[model samples]
Target: MPHSLPPAAPLRGRFDRFLILGAVCLAGFVLPLNFTGPPIATPAIAAELGGSPAALTWMTNAFMLAFGSCLMAAGALADGVGRKRVFGIGIAAFGVASSLLAFVPDLFWLNVLRVVQGVAAAAALSGGNAALAQEFHGAARLRAFSLLGTTFGIGLAFGPSLAGWLTQTHGWRSIFLSSVVVATAATVFGLPRMRESRDPAAAGIDVPGSLAFTAMLAAFTAGVLEAPARGWGHPLVLAALIGSGLLLALFVRIEQRSRRPMLDLALFRYPRFIGAQLLPIGTGFCYLVLIVLLPARLIGVEGYGALQAGLLMIALSLPMLVVPFVGAVASHRVPPGVLCSGGLLLAAAGLVWLGRADPGAGWIAPLLLIGIGAAVPWGLMDGLAISVVPKERAGMAAGIFGASRVSGEGVTIALASAALATFLGAGLQAALPGHAGRVAEIAQHLGIGDLAQARALLAPTLDPATLIGVYERAFGHLVDALAAATTVTAVLVLSLFGGASAHDIANTHEAPAARADGRPERVADCGAHG
Candidate 1:
């Protein structure tokens, strides 16, 4: 059945508007809080659960995979049914999952509950953004989206420190328990007042397209994530990669034919839209990956306690809180392409700076620069992408945009893990120049999170200077690789923006001639952005 539009009520007051943003934005807070929190809590979780470093990695992945997978479909459902209904369900579901996670009997159960949490987060994000797009128009839309971005940053900024403190003092389970309380309260208060809005004309979700895309992302991530431990050439890894390729091809075909595709392949026809999509991937790789990796590096390599490392990361996260508002305000004056491309290049510069930064000087400066740079695109791109679509499909567009983000995060981590593993293996070889057989054993031991072993593992044969150089070079290689990837991504995004029209730059949904069908015609002279 088609969605029935809610009767337009009187113009809400300032308090009501604030509450609307809070209702949605508060839900937005759930994801980053849980996702980044785990890196800080990993040691405690693993110690209690008796798992390895790889197992700890899955604690993040299990949630990410499910979140990315359900996002597109959830968006479609929200568009067809109603944003408030889906948003309420998402909050209740996440609250339930978080409560379950608080008492999870083992690591396996914790991971399982994370998937449920991801699904709930997906619905909440899509429904919240869709509601904002529906309720606010023109300049108010920009401000509303900015607030949404700001709320998202707040979640990211606090996740590490809070998780660290809670895990250190109250225990790892406190992190989840806290969320249970917050989410339950938010659902009780926020959901009731969240006015229902959705795309009345939207066809039901394209099941085949959604499943194929999910399969493609899942297989690809599985291949990349596991390749570090299993080897790229391992039968399982190769099979996964091959399956990902096949699934990707099938997804394209399905979308091309489906009347109501979850992801309209034609949206890529707009260079700005493509840039909008790719921009997030770079941001995710540069920003969120930093959120996870820096904590691990500080706590593991530098020998800082979890709490100390988390506190230090505040330098990196604080700028994220302010930059979104700056970018949102700047978007009115500057082109989306310019803001996005500039943000991407700035972030890449920060990555390169961090890649080469002297350990003695500390990461605070480079981390600060990275936060400022990432905030521009992170703050602006969602509004930019959704601007390319029609208002009715805002929920669906939001879903696709978010799916790209979470997918990028998962893929980047997987790639980073692979590169890190490769770098570590090479470091072992470099430290013990003549000992080929010992390298594999030493690498395996290091994978379990013992940083003291760099010198100790190779002590009898290698000197202190050699041991230190090995680690320095290994970390440098990982950082440099990420920097290179970001630079390349930025250049491509810039090129896309260079060729886009004014319409693409303004707001994707407002672009003229768009229809309910998934197909988009070749856009020539689609008006200029100004």
Candidate 2:
């Protein structure tokens, strides 16, 4: 039988939850910094390399796809091999990859390095939560999760600023170098004190299941990301989608029967868990749409430099720093459903407001609302997700939640890119009405300097002001679409809260003794020998 050890004792004495928080927070800093840093230099990088417009996106998407697909395996590995060991390995890999990225000669090599970096990130992110869940349970667990959420918020909040400063002072290569330094520091600080948490007997890594799931994720993500460039009907795109579906079916079948599955499908039985998963997906879709588009719009359409755009974008992260503590305090007194639903609603409202922001509007006010709105949902979602799962399976739960958020963001970006392209093409046609035909003709000529010649042909008649207006309108339309999606998420979260409110209230009123031990003691059963 799986060991049924009591939940780990709440941190007592000098070494408490705070130490664990600091250690894990150090590991958390590298991810958002690496992920968002590249995008801040997209225009510069593209210009310098003479790369395709779409090439810039791969810097971020490559990482997201690899990170999302590998998280499940990372979680299971942590369970079998030990969280600290897995974390150290991941941190080391990330540091090496980051160092390599600093010296990459071209975009292709950079993408290759990014994929490696993503795998390393998966190991750290997946294991961090698992280790925390194992080390701290009950109220202490809640506090630990809140701190993790805050750390993430802080990273996102400051990452762009850091990237902007680095890119300005030392160029884009500096961003990768920064990652190397941070990852190296985390490895050094974390390795000595980090404890092992995997319960070996219950934590068998399902290699076949992991492989199938990875194929499914990779195929589906590739289809989604490439669909904008290659129409959805294209053969390769269609094959990827079909293959993903089939592989996913196979993964489910394998997991259902596996002696020890990588995913704990049983957790979905809880409404809270289901809501937590879906809400993040919805919120992620909105969040990525805004974060990706805002900087591009500022830099490309508004003619702001990379640093200016990045500073404006910092609004997205600021609230992330403050909101989680609010959520943490509320978590102690209020039901998570209320906090989550309210946060989603706030985010929806902010997106709608942002959708209507004038192109020339003063930046501070709009950005402040956007920052606060984003922070609240981000702050609450992860903690709420972890709260719904039992301690033994927290790693699996965290992996699934993180994966869902990333997948949603990836799909959203693909769809948004297609929409923007269609809109921009139409706008360009309007802006260059008289020269449109000539521009198209030149574009298709395939002669030397064809693109430059086409630009020359269209340049005289293309009204810059009108073109900017069109792009802004299209951006607004995209933001509106994001707002709609966020609103739908808000409604779903509210409905969940309504449905579960009574049960939570009942639990709240239970005597202290009954409620104090409401969570079951199942740590030993988690495949850990100890």
Q: Pick the candidate with the highest lDDT.
A: 1
In model 1, how large is the Cα lDDT of residue 203? 77
Clashes of each: 11, 6
lDDT of 2 at 147: 77
Q: Stretches of candidate 2 above 4 Å error? A: 4-17, 360-363, 426-461, 499-530
lDDT of candidate model 2 versus the reference:
0.66
Clashing pairs in 2: 3-525, 199-527, 199-528, 200-527, 200-528, 202-527
| C-alpha local distance difference test of each model | 0.75, 0.66
Best by TM-score: 1
Q: What is the lDDT of residue 107 in candidate 1?
A: 83
What are the TM-scores, per candidate, against the unseen true structure?
Answer: 0.91, 0.86
Candidate 2 residues 1-530, lDDT tens each? 33443455454434644555566777677786777667767766766665545456677788977887788888778766777788888888988999998888898898888999998999988888787777765666656776777776677567777877788789989898888887777766556666666654444567888789778877876676566446679999899999999998999899878756676665555455566776666656556566665666666556677787777777776777777787667655766666666776677777777767665456556667656666666766676666554555666666777777665666666667666655555555666667554533322211111223234455655445655565667666777777787778777766655434322422322111111222222211111011
